[model samples]
Target: MPPVKKIVMWLVVIFLLYAIFTSPDSAADIFGSAWDVVANGVRNIGRFFDSLISRS
Candidate 1:
């Protein structure tokens, strides 16, 4: 990838590590929220496809 993209990725990694180390509870909450978001996204996609299949 490009240099800028690499730098941004490293920064994100460092920030996540700092967050986890500094506050475990806050980090757990953040990860839980992220999981919920991903689960909702997958559920929505499945519903969309199910609707299309039922209509046809």
Candidate 2:
């Protein structure tokens, strides 16, 4: 599991680095997509916690 996690992490890092280094447009797209994903994740987490707190 640890090895798999490490490999996945490295793959993501390498892909991001490649994207950033290869083309500015592609890098911008990648960054935008990543930002969207992170923002959505944070929103979801906040909603979940809020719901939990409200229920309690």
Candidate 3:
């Protein structure tokens, strides 16, 4: 990776650690919403493939 990308990544990691330590509840909610979005995307993919197979 480039130098700028590494610096940005480190900043994000530090901010996340700060958020986790300062306000755990808010961080948990943030993570929960993110997980829900990922889960829904995966479920939608599965449904799409299932329908395609069923039609064949």
Winning candidate number (TM-score): 3
Residues 1-56 of candidate 1 have per-residue lDDT tens digits of 69999999999999999999999999999999999999999999999999999998
- C-alpha lDDT score of every prediction, in listed order: 0.98, 0.92, 0.99
TM-score of predicted structure 3: 0.95
Model 1, stretches more than 4 Å misplaced? none
* Clashes per candidate, residues 3 or more apart or on different chains: 0, 0, 0
State the lDDT at 51 in candidate 3. 100
In candidate 2, position 45 carries an lDDT of 100
Better of 1 and 2 by TM-score: 1
Please name the candidate that would achieve the greatest lDDT relative to the true structure.
3
Poorly placed runs, candidate 3 (over 4 Å): none
Per-residue lDDT tens digits for candidate 3, residues 1-56, read 69999999999999999999999999999999999999999999999999999999
Better of 1 and 2 by lDDT: 1
Whole-model alpha-carbon lDDT for candidate 2: 0.92
